[model samples]
Target: MSQLDTAWPAGRDVPDVEKLIRQTREQEQQPVCAYIYDLVALRERAHRCVNSLPDECKLFYAVKANPDPQLIASLLPIVKGFEAASIGEIRTIRGVSGDVPIIFGGPGKKDAEIEEALERDVMLIHAESLHEVQRIGWIAERRQQRVSILLRINLRRTLPEASITMSGRPTQFGIDEIQVPEAIRLVQSLPFVQLEGFHMHSLSNNLDARLHAQMVATYLQCVQGWMQEYALSIRYLNAGGGFGISYTEPERRFEWNDFMEELHQVWEDYHIPGIQLIFEPGRYIVAHCGYYATEVIDLKTNHDQHYAIVRGGTHHFRLPVSWQHNQPFEVIAVDDWPYPFPRTEWRQTTITIAGELCTPKDVLAHEVDVEQLRIGDILLFHIAGAYGWTISHHDFLSHPHPHFYYINGT
Candidate 1:
């Protein structure tokens, strides 16, 4: 792929990976590293994805993945809105750009959160069930205001990597497909609630672009049928965010042009006159843009096998435990010459990676190869921009979170 295609904001030459690593070490900035190039690449990818969508479609950055204020601020101008799952995120977005449209989603929202969203005039409140709709309506009515709402709908597919799913069996999230009609009726009955359209978050690790298009088509059909049967005009259709990122080697990159083409075809086939398309892409937009930099505290041999132990563990990059995601990382000394090795050989050895914590589960990678891992060496874990630091446990042995930096080239 071209550099522009791989970098965020598009069209910039990134610093050499090895060069950046050496700089970090020469500065003695242990546990203080950033994925400068990765963030750039992620933004580029996201921009391409948004540009590929039809004119009517809108892209929303799901802030739950990594709510770095700088990242959100940088994306505000490029994206249509922000998908906030918590009150803090809502407030953060508002702090960055008050006028940026906000979509309040997630289950079990606190009353204060709803009140805050209403108080701030959020663009849309995604109601996961009839109860949430009623609650939002009650809050809006007491506040003497009307709020736009979308009923979160359950889908047919469930993702294995996600903590929550709207498909397959019963889930605590969106109302079931069968109950959507009644839920719609209830939402319509509420004076302060405006039923905008349907919202569905199928799965997180959805790599198939065609499957995404198929799901959109199916959802459009369902919404069309509902609109016709109920004689109601739906204003917005939200296909909730489940875009996947490459966390493992042989990483699967999201095919933006192909996916958008398929999505456009589906949109043309099921065009709704006055409806708007909204997409919440969290991981896809930020995953590859971030990296985790940790130092090799020690090295050892277990059963005649080499292992490099770093200061961080599953507490910092938990995708390995949560999704069994094996993110690719590179190891290099601060000033040592690059050890020459064939690509095929580098890919063949088993150099197990571990973190500083004592638990065996602290392992980061297994059967990986590094030129020469030694004490004080730095390892740069790539494509960690999405859920890397935010999802990790900082309290584990009281190891403070790594420092972060944001780099954008114009």
Candidate 2:
């Protein structure tokens, strides 16, 4: 059974969700750009789960999914910590929040990045591999400071549509589960190093809350078993985030209650004393809160195929290209076109949505249904708040980036 069946809220329908969307859209100012306040709502939902849990669990907002300064600034106070993938992201978090606990994630860490993280006094550094552990130690030794580190574990699990595979057969992230013993020995040998916990991030959307809970259970089991053998206990458990969001249909919702219930059950089954659970949620919190607004430049028809060429393309929102998923977009006339409703059979045709860029692969939607799209219309793509800004965009295209705005309060 899929996780959503058990984790989502019960008896909720699309109409209730649509009302919320329509209300937000009506009050929003135009040219409506991406807004990230929906992330706050998601955080609230996650907090419900965190608060209900028996153990001490902390949620860390992963900055890689959507690193808007304003979004991060708002979430810092609510969340326990922040997970940073790069030095720039670390800096961004530091600028907005002072001494907010941060976990330095990502595969490769340059010496300078490690030094900077050290200088900032980040709470934890998640070492992706043995080399990274030694490198961090070297940097920490140079700075005369001890660094608390977590060894990321490769669980040998496969995920669908993952760009970079981190487990199963020769993955590039963390030490293999088999290598944990050696990793522990290596950490024990270093006098200036402190081994805090084990970290694992498996791919999952909010829709698959049960799977997320199961993965977390597996991670805790492994760590607990290892600790039992070594007569040691970790202070933290970092279960990395892969919470999914609805990009195609805004009405399709995630069942958070069921997801949290499953998570609570898993933790209850394997209760560990004094180990704080840490979650790094990046996309689930921010994806729905954002939208990408573009102006329809022109419309053309060829061989019964209609095309709406917009000012923005894969350069602006990369999910259509990277994930091969359709984003829900509404085409409204910039200035209302005068038309009367005809009492005839209206036919919906499939059209290819293309971006303004020169690349042929810049197609946004291959086949979408619309009611007679015309020139000078505006298209607003929904649920583009996460992984939309940085995936397929290249500055070489030379097109100006889309302006970003946020709904101030709600």
Candidate 3:
């Protein structure tokens, strides 16, 4: 049987992740610090999301989440396309699959990046500002080519708040809703640019399923209003994704099925014929499939608070520290003690899991209660697939980078 079959015999909910972690630990000679990815789990999750999507909606993987080449390759067949925020991300996706559809979206895009996007014949360039639309037109005119684009709008309407708010506020992301009329006129006047649609991406890491559906409905309502008032002949409406992965409460996940049910109602109400809906989600797609494993090197008490310093810290997996939340972790007890002295053990205590960094801010989990933790035990961080390694500052302390391992179950 494959590792997946051995680990997940009954269902996906019950996985022997510890078995895989133990296997990875046994291979390392020194203190282990590595990232373990379950490709089977990733594919399963992607398939679930793809299956849940409505016929009007197209799923695209945002490359900013985890741009691992293997991860990108794995997601290519499952998602409709890849959404790249930078030229480097575009190149990274291209390196994985040359002809796969790509949509470039970001603020303050360079002229060269626009030219490159035109050269690549991307599905759409999400234009942030009217000036950016002008620049795209200029570059396309210079290249003697016509480029398709989606005007990314910063709508003025009140929006549901998220951890990171990209629009409906003063942000350097999209064009203001009031200025969208001028933008429409400019796009219509530009001979080299074909205005394909509108891109309204507002929130990041939004968890409420009903509220999320309502938000998408609100976006559709706003876009339809613009289409009627501006007489815009648009064929695509990109409602960017911000599906949340609950780090604080892992069991309470975002209800995609519930979201889908409400989304069907929204589609029935607002989906225009011949217009496609696109959702570019990054974190929710791959977070549960990854594990960051670090070996504990020290156990101490500072100011009557227990602490466990591991071989790696925020330098390797910085998601916990970046989001200011105690990431969920499981202790894999290792009995082998190589030291001449007795192994130090911290028992039945609430321990703060910290990395080997010199700074106090390098903690991963604070005041987390554990049954029994020792110097030789390993801490496996859960839900670390997306925005983990890619978002971390690896070279901060000039420490060694963690090893990466993938279980394809083939």
For each candidate in the order shown, give its overall lDDT on alpha carbons.
0.75, 0.72, 0.86
Clashes of 1: 11
lDDT of 2 at 33: 31
lDDT score at residue 205, model 2, on the 0-100 scale = 63
Clashing pairs in 2: 6-258, 7-258, 7-259, 8-255, 205-244, 206-244
Q: What is the TM-score of each candidate against the true structure?
A: 0.89, 0.85, 0.95
If ranked by TM-score, best first, what sequence of candidates would result? 3, 1, 2
Q: lDDT winner among the candidates?
A: 3
Which 10 residues in a row give candidate 1 its minimum summed lDDT? 1-10
What are the runs in model 1 whose C-alpha is more than 4 Å off?
Answer: 1-18, 29-39, 156-165, 249-251, 336-349
Tens digit of per-residue lDDT, candidate 1, span 1-410: 11224323321333455556566666754543444434455566667777778879999999998898888877877899899999999989999997999999998998889998888879999898788888998999999999999888875554344444566567787888888779988988889889889897777757666677778888888899899998888799998778655566344655565577788789989989899989998987877677677877666778898777787878877877667656677765544433474211222446888887768888778877665655666777776777767787868888766655555654
lDDT of 1 at 331: 67
Clashes of each: 11, 6, 0
Backbone clash pairs in model 3 (N, Cα, C under 3 Å; residues 3+ apart or in different chains), count: 0
For candidate 2, write residues 1-410 as lDDT tens digits: 11233233211232333344445445655323332234444455445535655558788888998888888876876788899999999999999987899999889889999999889889999988888888888777777899999999887654333333455557677788788888898888887789999888755464555666777788888889889997775799888777666656545545565567788888889868899888887776677566666756667777887777887788878888887877777665444333464222123757788988887788878888887565545576666777888675647479767666555434
State each model's C-alpha RMSD to the native: 4.6, 5.0, 3.6
The top-ranked prediction according to TM-score is 3
Q: Write the per-residue lDDT of candidate 3 for residues 1-410, one digit (tens) a residue.
A: 01111111111332466776677777778798888888888888788778867786899999898999899988989999999999989989889887999999999799988888777768899999988988999998888898999999998888887889999889998999899889999999999899999999899999787888988888889888888998878888899989887889755667777787888888888788788999999988888788888999998888998889999999999889999999988888887887899888877899899899999999999998998898989898888889999888999979999989887876
Better of 1 and 2 by TM-score: 1
